[model samples]
Target: MEIFIVVLILLLSIVISNILSRLIPFVPVPLIQITFGIILGVLPTGIHMPLEPELFMVLFIAPLLYNDGKMTSREELWKIKSPVFLMSFGLVLATVLIVGYIIHFMIPDIPLSASFALAAILSPTDAVAVSSLSERIHLPEKIMTLLEGEALTNDASGLVAFKFAIAATVTGVFSFANAALSFFVIAVGGFLVGAVLALIIARLTAFIRRLGLEDATFHVLMQIISPFVIYLVSEELGLSGILAVVSGGIVYSLQSDYSEPIISKLKFVSRSTWSVLIFIINGLVFLILGLQIPDVMSVIFRDDTISNFKVLMYIVVISIVLILLRFIWVYSLWNEKWSVNESIEENPNRFLNSLLTSLAGVRGAITLAGAFSIPFYLENGQYFPQRDIIIFISAGVILLTIFIASFVLPLLVKNKNIEADKNSSKLNQQALKSVMNAAIRLINDETNQENKLAASSLINVCEKIKNDNPIDKEDIKLTIEDRKIEKDIFLLGIRAERKEVRRLLSDNKIPPATYEKIDNSLTKVENCLSKPPIIETLNRMDSIKNFISKFLKKQLNVNPINIKDIKKIKVLTSKAAIYAIKEQINDTNKKASLAVIDHYNDIIRRLTTFTIGEDINNVNKQRSKLHLKALQAERDQVQSLLQNNEINRETALKLRNFINYMEATAIEEQSF
Candidate 1:
C-alpha cells in the first residue's frame, strides 16, 4: 500500500508537470518536472522516496537504453562510430582521470577513489533530457546523432568505471591490468549474451507462429519483458546488464522485418506503449531525484568543515571543469588535423557544435543512482569518506547543468538560419496539399455511383469540404425533400468523421491523444443524432452535467490545429462533395440538390480565390472567417429545416450542436 501510494504520487506529479509545461511552453518540461519534485520535497507530508540503485537500473535504465538502441539509426551510428567511441569511452576515461584528480585536490577530505567514482558516474550524459531540450531548437544533424550515440554507449562504460572505483575505495587496493581485463570481459560478454538471447527469442517467435499461436499482444509483451530478462541474466553472470540490454535491443531491431504488414501493425502498438513507459520512467526518475535531494542537502549542511557557499562553489567548479574538458575533447575531434580524411574540417559550425556538445553533456538521475550505491563503510570498518557530500554534489550538478542548458542552448540556437525553417514549412504545406489532392482523385475515379456518393459525404465532413460561392443567409429555404437529403448528409458525415480520424491515427499524422479527443466529440454527437427526441434531450442534459464535472476536476485542453492542413482537407472535401452531388443530381430532387451544390461551390470560391501573396497570418484569418460563415450558414439551414417540419426536434438539435462544435474548433484554431 505504501509502495502504491508512492507510485500514485509520482504519477500525479508527472501529470501536474505536463499541465504546467503546456501552460508555460518557454520552460523545458524536464525542468518543470524537477521543480514539481522539489515542491513535493518541500511539502511537510514527510515523503521519502528511496533510491534503490539496482532496482532503478533494472526498472528504468534497462528499458530506456533498450529503446534508445532500437530507435537510433544504425546507418548514422556506423557513419560516426569513431566519434561515438571517442566521446563514450575516451572522454569518459579522460573525465575520470582529470576531473577525478581535480575534485580530490579541491576537496582533500574526499578520498581519491571516491572522487573518481563521482566523476565516473557524472561522465555519462542524459541523452533523454538533451533530446527533450533539442525538440525546441533545431540541432545540427551530426551533433544530435553523436549525442544520442554517446549517451547510448557511455551509460554502461560510466557505470562500469564507477563500480571499479567503488571497489578500489572499499578494499583500499587498485590494479589497472586486472580492471582493464575485467572491463573487456564484462563489455564483450554482455554483448555476446544479449545477441544470443535475441536470436533465441527470434527463433522462439518463429516456432510459435508455426504452432499457430500468433498474437500481437503476446509478442509485444515478450518484447517488453525481454530487456529485463536479458539484464537480469547478464548481471547474474557478472556481465554488464546495461550493455546487454543495449545489444539485445539492437539485435532485435536487426532481426525484425519492418516491411511486413503484421510488423507494421505491431509497431503502432509498440511505439505507443514504449512512448508512455519512457515518459513515466523519465518523469519518476527526475521526481525521485528531487525527493532525495532534500535529505542529501541536509546531510551536506551537517558537515561543519565545509561552508554552504564553498560547497556550492565546488559544484560550480566541477561542472565547469566537466564542460571544459568535454569541449576540449569534442573540439579536438572537430579539428582539421583530426578530420584529414573527412570534409568536416570545412564546416563553419564546429565551434558552436563543440560548445553545444559540451553543454548537452548534462548529468541526470544515473549519477545520483550511482552515488546512492556508494558503500557506507570501507574495509577498516570506518565510514566511506564524504559519501553524503558526494551525493549532494552529484545532485547539485544535475540541477545546475539542466538549468544552464535550458537557457543557454536556445540563445545559441537563435543564430540558426530562419530561411531554412521557412523552406521546411513550405515543403510540408506542399506535401499536405499533394496528399489531399491524391485522396480526392482516388474518390473521383470510383466507378460505382453509390460507393462514390457514400465516400464523398464522409470526405465532406472530415475534410470540411467547401465550394466556390458563399451561400447567402436567406438562400437556404429547406423543403421536406431538402431536409431528407441534409439528414442523410449529416448522418453520413458523422460516420465519416470517425473514419477519417482513425485513418489519420493509423497514418501517424495525428497523435493518439488528439484522435481520442476528436473521436469522443464525434461519438457524443452521433449518440444524440441517433436517439429519440426525449433521449436526445436527456443525453444533452447528461453531457452538460459531465462537462461541469470535468470542468470542476480537469481543464479540457484541445490540441492546436494546423490551419494549412485544415484548409487542404477542406479543399479536397469540397471536390469530393461536388463530384458526389453531380452524381446524385441525375437521381435525386434536382432543385434541392442544386441548392446544396451552390452552398459548397461558394465555399470553394472563397477558399481558392484568396490572394496568394497575403502573409500566412492574413490567410489564416481570412480562412477562419470563411469557416465561421460556413458554420453559421449550416446552423441557419438546420433552423430552416426545423421550421419547415423537414427535420424533427432531435435532428435539428443535433445539427445545431455539431455546427457549434465546428465553430468552437475554428475559433480555437484562430488563436494559434
Candidate 2:
C-alpha cells in the first residue's frame, strides 16, 4: 500500500509538472519536473527510488528509441547520414576521450577509468531536451534533423563506451583494440538480430491474418511490445540492445502496410500509446534525477577529501569544457556545410549556427541513467571509488546543459512568428468549414428515413461548428442588441429545460440522482451566463434573474405527470421554448430568435429519436455507419483542400485530426 501510494504521488507530481510547464511555457517541462522532484525529496514522504540501468533501458530507452526510429524520415536521414554518423559516433568518442582526461586532471582523486566512465555517460546529447527548448523557437530544420539523428544513434555508441570503461574499472583491465572489435560485433549483431526478429513477427502476423484472424488492437499491442522483446533477445545474445531496438523499429516501419484502413487505425493507436508512454517515462527520468540529487549531494558534501566549493567548481568547469568541446567539433563540421537544407549563400552566418548547435547538445535521460548505473561496489568487494561524487557531477552536468540550452538557444535562434500563427489559425478554420460542408452534403443525400433523421441532426452540429469558428475578427464582432437577444434566448431555453427536469423528478419519472445531475448541469450554464462576482453583487444579480422564477416556483403545485408524459417531456419543453421565442420575436430580433429556435428544434429531433427505443441495435448500427461516412467525407474534403493548396499541411493535419477524433468517438460509442 505504501508502494502504491508512492507510485501515485510520483505520477501526481508528473501531472502537476505538466500543468506548470503549460502555464509557464517559457520554462522547459523537464526543469519543472525536476523542481517538483526536488520538493518531494525534502518532504516527509521523500522517495529514494532505485535506478537500475538494465531496467531503465528496457522500460524507457528501448521503446523511445524504437518510436524515434519509426518516425524519422528515411529520406531526410539518408541526406545527412554522414553528418549524423560523425556526430553520433565520432563526436561521442572524442568527447569521452577529451573530457575523461580533463576530469581526471581536475580531480586527481577520481581514477582515469572512472573519469572515462563519467565522460561516456555524459557524451550522448538529448534530442528530447533540445526539442523542449525549441518549443518556443524553431531551430533551423537542418540542425534539428541533425540533432535528432545524432541523438538516435549516439545513445548506443556512448553507452557501449561506458560499458567498456566500467568493465575495465571492474576487472582492472583496459584494451582499446579489443573494445573496438567487440563494438563492431555487438553493433552488427544487434542490428541483424532486431531486423530478423521484426521480420519474423511481421510474417507471424500475416500468417495469423491468413487464418482469418484480424484485430488491429492486437497487432498494435504486438508492435508496442516489440522493443522490449527485441531488447531482451539482443541482450541475451550478448549484443547491443539499443541498436537492436533501433533497427527493429526501422525494419517494422518498412514492413508496415500503409494503405490498409486497419493499418491506419493501428498506426493511430500505436502513435498515441507511444506518445503517452514516452512522455511519462521521459518525465519520470528527470523527476527521479531530482529525487536522487539530495542524497548524491549529501554524500559529496560530507566527504572530508573534497570541499563543497571545489565540487561546485568541478561541475561548472566540466560543463563549460563539454560545451566548448562541442562548439569546436561543430565548428570543424561547418567546412562540410553540415549538409544543411538551407544554402550557405542564403544564410551565411555559419559560426552562429554552429554555436547554436553546440548549445543544443543538452545531456538528459541517458546521462542520468548511466551515472546511476555506476556499480556501487567494485570487483574486489570495495565500494566503487567516488561513486556518489561521480553521480553528483553527472547530475550537475545534465542540469547545467539543460539550463543553458533553455535560456541560450531561444536567443540564438528567433523563430517565433505571431503573424504566421494567426494565418495558420485562419486556414485551420477554413479547412474545418470546408470539411463540415462536405459532411453536411453527405448526410443530406442519405435515403434511409431513420439514418437520415439521426444523421440529419448532426448537420446542425456541423453548422454550429462552422458558425462558431470565425475566420476573421470582423466576423466575431456582435452588436449590443444581438448580444442581448442571444443572452435572453439562452436563459429562456435553460429555464424550459429546468422546468421539464423538475416536473419529471417530482412525478418520480427520473430518480434523484438523475435529477441532481440535470440540475447541476443547468446551474452550470446559468452560472456561465452571469459571471461569478462578489457576494453582494451576486445576490443582486440573482434577485433580478429569479424574480419571475420565484413566482413560477409557487405555480408548480400541480398534478403528477404520467410515464407517457415523461417520455414526451424533453421534446415538449423544447417546443415550448421555441414557441416562447417566436412569441417574443420581433423584426429586429428575428435573426437571433431563429438561431436559438434552430438549436431547440435540434433538441426536439434528438429527443424524438431517443423515444424510438425499439430496435435500438439496428438504429445504432445505422447511426454509426452514417457517422463514419460523414467523417470520411470530411477527411476526403481535407485531402482535396490540401492537394489544391487551399490549406497548408499543418492546417490540413489539424482538420484531419479533428475528424479522426470524431470518427474514433463514433466507433467507441458503437463498441460500448
Candidate 3:
C-alpha cells in the first residue's frame, strides 16, 4: 500500500508537471519536477523513494543510452567523427583532470583521487538537457550536433575514468601505466560485448518472428531488457557497462532499425514507448536526486556536517573550471590541426559557437547516478573518504550547470542562425524540379483519366511546395512554436471514429451486442477537404505509427492478448495509449470515407473507383472475399502448425493475425 501510494504521488507529480509545462511554456517540465520532488521529500509524511544506484543505472540510463545510439545516424556521425572524438574523449579527459585538481585544491581535506571521481561524475554532458536548452536558443546546427555527438560517447568515457578514480581511492594506489592499460581493456572489451550481443539479438529477432511469437508486448519487453542485459554482462566481465550499452545501440541502428519497416503500428509504439519512458526516467532521476540530499545529510553527516558555505564555493569554482577547460581546448584545437571542423572553424561566428558548446555541458541524471553509486565503505571497511561531501558537491555542480546552461545558453546564441552549405538548398530545389517536371510530362502524355488526375494532384503539390517555400532557414524560436502547434494538433487531431449503430442507435462507448444495434467505424475525420493539410498530416502520422508499431511488435515474443485489447488497457506507447484513452472516454458521432482512388485498368478499358458507379462498386466488392480468403489461410496455417507439433494447442488458439490479413487485403483490393 505504501509503495502504491508513493507511485501514485510520483505519477501525479509528473502529470501535474506536464500540465504546468504545457500551460506555462516558459518553464521546462524537468525544473518543475525537480522542485516537486524536493518538496515531496521535505513533507512530514516520512516517505522517501528508494533510488538504489544499481536499479537506477540498469533500469533507467542503459535504455536511455541505447536509444540514443540506435537513433544516431552512422553516416552523419562518421562525417563529424573527428570533432565528436575531440569533444568526447579529448574534452572529457581535460575536464576530469583540470576539475579534479581544482576541487582538490579548493578543499585540501578532500583526496585527489576522490576529487577525480567527482570530476568524472561531472564530465559527461546531458544531450537531452542540452537539446531542451538549445530549443530556446538558435545554436548552430554544427554546434548542436557537436554537443549531441560528444554526449553520446562521453558518458562511457567519463564513467570509465570514474571507475579507475574510485578504485584508486578505495585501495590507495595510483599507477598511470596500469590506469591507461585498464582504460583500453575496459573500453574495448565493453564495445566487443555490446556489439556481439546486439548481433545475436538481431538474429534472435528473426527466429522469434518465424516462431509466430511476435507482438507489442514482446517488443516492449525486449526493449526494456536489452540495455540491462548488455550492462549486466559487461559489468560481470569487469568491463564498462556504459560503453557496452552505447555500442549496442549504435550497432543496432546500423544493423536493424534503419531497414525499411513493415509493421507500422509497432514502429509507432516503439518510438512512443522509448520517448515517454526516457522522459519519465530522467524526470524521476532528478527528483530522486533532490530526495537524496536529506538522506545523505541525516545519515552520513549526523556527527559532523560538512561546511556548506565552503562546499558552495567549491561547486562554483569547479563548474567554472569544467566550463572554461572546454573553451580553451576547443579554441586551441578547433582549427589548429583539424579538417573535420574546417567549415565550422572558418565560420565568422566560430568563437561564439565554441563558447555555446562549452557552456552547454550540463551535468545531468547519469552524473548524479555515478556520484550516488560510490560505495559507502572502502576496503578497510571504515568509510569511503568524504562520500557525503562528494555527493553534495556533485549535486551543486548539476544544479549550477543545468541552470546556467539552460538559461544562459539561449542568451549567448540569440540571433545566431546555423545553416547548411549554400549549395545544399540549390541542390534540393534542382532535385525537386527534376522529379516534378518528369511527373508533369508523364501526366500530359498519358491517355488515362485516373493517371491524369493523379498527375494533376502531384503537380499542384509541387507548385504549393515551391510557392510556400517548404525549406526555411533554421529559426529556433519559430521552430519551437511550430513544433508546439503540431504537437497540439496531433494530440487533438484524430476524429471520434466509433459509431454504435445498425439501423437506429448511436453509442460509441458501448460494446457491440447481437440483439442491440451495433456498428464499428475505423479512424475518421471531418472536413478533410477543407483541412487538407491537417488531413495529410493526420494520414502521415497514422501510417508512420502503424508501420513502427508493427515493426517493433514483430521483433518480440508472441503474446496471448490481441492488439486491440492491448491498445485499450494502457499501451507501452504512452502517446498512442493517450489517444486510445481519449477515444475510449469520448462519445461522438464521427464518420469517414476513404480517399476514393480512381484507378484505371489499361487492359479492361475502364475506370474502377470505390462507390463511384454501380459497375465500379461491383468491381471493388471483391474486398470482402479477399479478406475471407486471408482469414481462411491463417486458419489453415495455424491448424497445420498445431498438427505438426510446432506449437501447443493453447498457443495455436491465440494465433491472431486476422487484423493484419484484413488490412493487407484492404490495401490489395485498392489496386486497379
Candidate 4:
C-alpha cells in the first residue's frame, strides 16, 4: 500500500511539473518540477521514495544519458570533435583537481581522497538540461552541439574518475598507471560492443525487409530495446555504457534503410514516444530535487556542529566560481591560436556569439547524480567529510544556474544575422513564385491543337502575377473566386454531357461501340475533376515563371508576356475553344496515366501536373475553344448531309450540340 501510494504521488508530481512548464515560459522546467517536489516533501502526507543511491543513479542517470547520445547529430559532433574532447576530458580533470585542492585546504578535517571524489562527481554537465535550455534560447547550433557532445562524453569520464577516486579512498591505495590503463580499456571496449551490436541489428532488419515482412510494430520494438541492450552489454564488459549507446546510435544511423516506408512510420512513432519519455523523466527529476529540499534543510538545522549560514554561503560562492570558470575557459580559448572559429572569416559578432554560448552552460541531472553518489563513510568508520554539505551546495548551484539561463541568458544574447519571424515571410514569398512558373511551362509545351485552349487558360493564370501581387490579400481573394467559378462550370458541363450520353445509350439511338467509347471518356473526365488542385504544381509553376521572367528581362530584347492580357484572352476564347482543347487535354492525361503503367521515367512528373482539379476547369476552357475549331472542320460533313436531305437544320443543330458536349467533356478531362 505504501509503495503504491509513493508511485502515485511521484506520477502526480510529474504531471504537475509538466503543466507548470507549459504555463511558465521564463522558468526552467526542472526548477519548476523541483519546487513542486519540495512542497510535496514538506507536506504531512507526502510520499518518500527511500531509494538506494546506486540503484537510483543507474536507473535514472544512465538511461537519460544514453537517450541523449541516441538523439544527438553525429555529423555535427564530428565537426567540433577536438574541442569536445578537450572540454570533456581535459577541462573536467582540471576542474576536479582544482576543486579538490581547494576543499582539502579549506576543510582540513576532510580526507584528500574524499575531496577529490566530490570534485570528480561534480565535474560532468547534464546534456538534457543544457539541451532543453539551449533550444528555448536559440543557442547557436555549433556551440549547442559542442556542449551537448561534451556533456554526453564526460558523463562516462566523470563516473570513471569518481569510481577510481572512491576506490583509492576505500582501499588506501592510488596508482596513476592503473587508472590510465583502465580508462583506455573501458572507453575502447564500449565503442566495440556498441558497434558490433548495432551492425547485427541492422543486418537482421535488412533480412526481414528482404523477406517482405517489414512492419512498423516490429521496427519500433527493435528501437525500444536497442539502447538498453547496448548499455547493459557495455556495462557487463566493464565499459562505458554511455559511450556504448552513442556508438550504437551512430552505427545504426549509418546502416539502417531509413528511406523504407515501414522505417519511416517507425521513426515517427519512436520520435513521439521518446519526446514524451524525456519530458516526464526531466520533469520528475526536477520535482524530486525540489521535494528533497526540506529534508536537506532539516539535516542542516538539526546538526548544530556545522553552521547552516556558513554552509549556505559556501554553496553560493562555489556556484559563482563554477559560472565564472566556464566563462574564463571559453573566452581564453577564443583568444588563443587554437580557438573555435579561428580558421573561419572573422566578424565582430563571433565574440558575442561565443560569449552567449559560454553563458548557456547550466547544470542539472549529472550534478545531482554525482552529488548523490558520494559515499556515506570514509575508510576509518568516519563519515565522508562534508558529503551532506556538498550535496546541498550542488543542488543550490543547479537552481541558480537554471534561473540565470532561463531569464538572464535571453537578455544578454541576440542573433544578429536573421530572426525566425523574418525568415518565415521570406520563405513564403520564394515558394509562391516558384509554383507559378512551373504551371506556365507545362501549358506552353502542348503540341496538339486540341490542347492549345487548355494550355492558354493555364498561361493566363501564370500571367496574372505579372500585373498583380501574387501574395497580396485582395489578389488571393480574386484568384480564389476565379478558381471557384471555373470549377463550377467544368463540373456542370460534365454532369450535363454524362446525362445526355447515358440517355442516348439507354434508348439504343447510339451504336454500342460509340456508347462504350463515350462512357469510358466520361469516366476519365469524372476522375480528373474529382481531384483538387496540386499545391506543388502551383509552387513549381511560380518558380519556373519567375526564372523565365528574370531571364527575359536580363537577356532577351522582347517584352515580357502580359499576364492580365492572357487572363482576358482565356475569358473571351473559352466558348469557342472548349471541344478541341478538351480532346487534346484528355489525350495528354491518358498518355500520362499510360506512362505510369508502362513505367516511363517522366510519367510521375507529368501525372503530378495533369491531375489537378483546377486543371479540369482549364481543360473545359480549352475544349470550348477547340470545339469551335472542330465545328469548322465538320462544316463540310454537315453540309453534305444537308445537301443529301438526310437531316433537317434542327437535327443538324442537335448533332452539333452533341459533338460540342463530347469535345468539352474530353478537353476538361486532360488539362494538364
Best by the lDDT measure: 2
**Can you give the TM-score per candidate against the true fold?**
0.68, 0.69, 0.64, 0.61
Q: Which 10-residue window of candidate 1 scores lowest in summed lDDT?
A: 465-474
Which numbered prediction scores highest in TM-score against the true structure? 2
Model 1, CA-based lDDT: 0.70
* Model 3 lDDT per residue over 297-338, tens place: 555445455665666787798888888888888777775222
Model 1, range 311-340, lDDT digits (tens) per residue? 999999999999999999999887433222
lDDT, candidate 4, 485-547, per-residue tens: 333445544455556656666787555545444444445544444432243245346448756
**Clashing residue pair totals per candidate (backbone < 3 A):** 14, 0, 20, 49
Error of 4 at 9 (Å): 4.2
The residue ranges of model 2 lying beyond 4 angstroms of the native Cα positions read: 127-140, 257-259, 335-349, 376-383, 413-672
Cα RMSD for predicted model 2: 9.3
Identify the runs in model 1 with alpha carbons over 4 angstroms from their true place. 335-347, 417-419, 426-599, 602-672
Error of 3 at 411 (Å): 1.2
Q: How good is model 4 by TM-score?
A: 0.61
Question: Candidate 2 — worst ten consecutive residues by lDDT sum?
Answer: 471-480
